[model samples]
Target: MARGAASERDGSLSDGVRPGEEPADAAPPALAIEGLSKRFGDGAASVLAVDDVGLTVERGSIVGLLGPNGAGKTTLIKCTLGIVLPDSGSVRVFGADVTDGRRAAYANVDAMLEGARNDYWRLTVRENLRYFATIAGVDPDSVRGRHDRLLDRLELTAKADTPVRELSRGMKQKVSLASVLAGGAELVFLDEPTLGLDVESSRTLRRELRRLAREEGLTIVLSSHDMDVVEDVCDRVVMMANGRIVADDTVAALRSGAGDVVRVVSADVDDAVVATLRERFDVRGVETDLGAVERDGDRRDGGDRRGPTAVEVAAGGDALYDLMDALRAAGVTVEGIETVRPELEDVFVDLTGVEPGEGGSDEGGSGEGDLSDAAADSRGRSP
Candidate 1:
């Protein structure tokens, strides 16, 4: 919504035309990087944080940047934001090359990294918004209405005059996002934007982000460990591993490509049954319905009243039939069976060999260009 005034001032919105209405000579992508490579150190100790990566983000789209720690995600983001210089690559923002000048390239960009630390804790919420807007080369008075709307939407109007240090973590996180938007940035990067938010606040922020992208032609590159948020909000997901882009596609496409799993719920399933199934099929997990077992008085101390066990097996295509045969041979009575579509989290784990929310080494090479670097970068220019 803030971009309306910004477009008039700088023509950042597709060179004065609205989104999807660009002329034959349309503007370049909101952000683009080619042959991007970055490494820290040298010799045997060197770490290739980004390995010849290339990426493009279109305007008015929400793309999820997903990867586990040490997957080069943080390094890639820092390089894109100009916080970390790439060893070899070219970064272009809104048709302007970052090498030529970041002031022009990232003029309409902003970011929130490391949660609420991006904001000035001593400043009031409104003051922080105005301060960031001024630094972004926009008159705070010109976008006061936009700031008000952001505060209202994020439920921070009541705390507008309150010092950011006095607010709760979630509220301060909201302030950080509001400050990023206050400058009418057309492209934004948000890392863990909903890190400390409650359910209601998180939903509110997601709704607003979607509206901003759809209505204001804002482009977002979001990085988060929250798979549910990424699945719900992102139009496309780009996953990285070992400094390489392993998968990039829509959330639905990624899930579909991950192959379907079969879940069998059986009251007779036990360790022996699970082992047998594992021998025949790839058993993903075996979860016992503890509540159901308690209700049936099937505690271990009681009798052999085993409760229902849900066995998640990778039994797609012909494997399903063979799995059924195995179950029949085992004399197991299936209570229910259904095809389980892989979630984004499942796809992520399959591709990266890392569990969701798992943390690893600092991808920026010995923790270089981390949150502290991001904070310092955000203060000087568009993050």
Candidate 2:
């Protein structure tokens, strides 16, 4: 939410308004949540899906919502969208509280959950856009220009007249996204937006999302298991675990906080050598390239099949020196050594104690069936 001094001069703020002063017509943050809590059941069977969470997403920013399965991400989003009412706390969209009037608060909000929306299969891609726009209380004809642009940007213009049911899954996904934006929603929630996209299509979508946020001042809350997309497109990341926010910061800050590890590749490293190194250092993992020694002409005589082994040790600061000294004592000649910075996935694992794709099935107490039902209900109604 911090704005630079240059923002004032660059017309980022209302004219003549000083820094931190809100103009009468100034828009509030795209979304706001305070002390939000949701529980599925009572007594011993109860599960806290969202645990007194508070978050604010600035206009024109992309915030990545990340967590492993059953992390309450889905439940939290459902609560925010009024698909699942919270036990306590409040959700406000565009300065209107949902409790006051969901229709007014979410008038300009739209979401694509689980990688796709429920687009009309019988309608053409263009018709689907117009239909969604109409249901959202916008005149389809009035936003034809925007619809055209969305189709062009998503590379669906050629198939705009094609029936959505006849399109490939990837194309249908694109149409779903197009439908979400056809109404010119100011705030959009996209879950796994790039799920069915190819590499090129995914890149296109990423570029379009950045452009929309930068040029049109669109705000987005993106949830995806694809760390690269989140890191590439999001301004900030909010990570959840056990129905609570564990880390909320920029991707760079998270990675930097996780520190760095040392990768040591040596031709002399065998199981015994790795075991010795493990005793002295934090060995994250080891990969043995069976053909590396033959390829690099480091193969030994006497029918030794051992090849170059690369071991990643979580050795930061002075620990790195100890790792090197131990390797030398083991009579290991280092072939390659470099410090490897932790990625978002690495930091996620460090904080959550599990890989992004592995976790329990429940989001708080609600199962996948509950989430799907909520999503389906949301899609059936116009925000």
Best by TM-score: 1
Give TM-scores for every candidate, taking all chains together and pairing residue i with residue i.
0.89, 0.87
Clashing pairs in 2: none
For candidate 1, the per-residue lDDT at 212 reads 88
Candidate 2 deviant stretches above 4 angstroms = 1-27, 115-117, 293-304, 363-366, 379-383
What's the true lDDT of residue 352 in model 1? 94
Give a tens-digit lDDT track for model 1, residues 35-95.
9998888788788889999999988899999988888888888888887799998999888
Candidate 2 RMSD computed on C-alpha atoms after optimal superposition onto the true structure = 5.8
Candidate 2, lDDT over the whole model: 0.80
lDDT of 1 at 240: 95
> For model 1, what is the C-alpha lDDT against the true structure?
0.82
**Highest lDDT among the candidates is held by which one?**
1
